[model samples]
Target: MRRWRGRFLARLRAIAPRYPPRREVDRQARADMAASSVEGGLPGRRRANPSMLPRRIPLYRELIRATFQPE
Candidate 1:
């Protein structure tokens, strides 16, 4: 058990830089993509759907549209 654990840790250290954990790499990649794809200051996650806006509040909808122009 001790030998296996040591080997595992050694292997992990060796591969840490060459191949970081998938989830972390994916998250960083997603952040980069979001930054590059941004039309305004807002990220991809905050993208608003105009159709979802309430019909009763046209002013608020217009403000949102003015703030976030489509790319």
Candidate 2:
């Protein structure tokens, strides 16, 4: 019974995905982010402007409607 259990655990370990250590994973993520930023693959945050509120917000939609009335 003990040998069978050990063999089963070993087989499971062999089939399981091997993940990098936490520190290594973090380092890789940082490196990827840095590379993407350098290559312009990642977008930077938009500068805060009162006139440029996100369109998805109700307040922004109301502001747009108020600013542009139809003749």
The number of clashing residue pairs in each candidate reads: 0, 0
Candidate-wise lDDT, in order: 0.40, 0.36
lDDT (tens digit, per residue) of candidate 1 on 1-71: 34434543454455546555543333333333333333223333355643322332455334333433343
TM-scores of the models, in the given order? Answer: 0.30, 0.24
For candidate 1, give the lDDT.
0.40
lDDT of 2 at 32: 40
lDDT of 2 by residue, 1-71 (tens): 34434553453344334432322223333334333333332122333443233322445334333433333
Off by over 4 Å in 2: 18-71
The model with the greatest lDDT is: 1
* Number of the top-ranking candidate, with TM-score as the measure: 1
Each prediction's RMSD over C-alphas, in Å, is: 18.8, 22.9
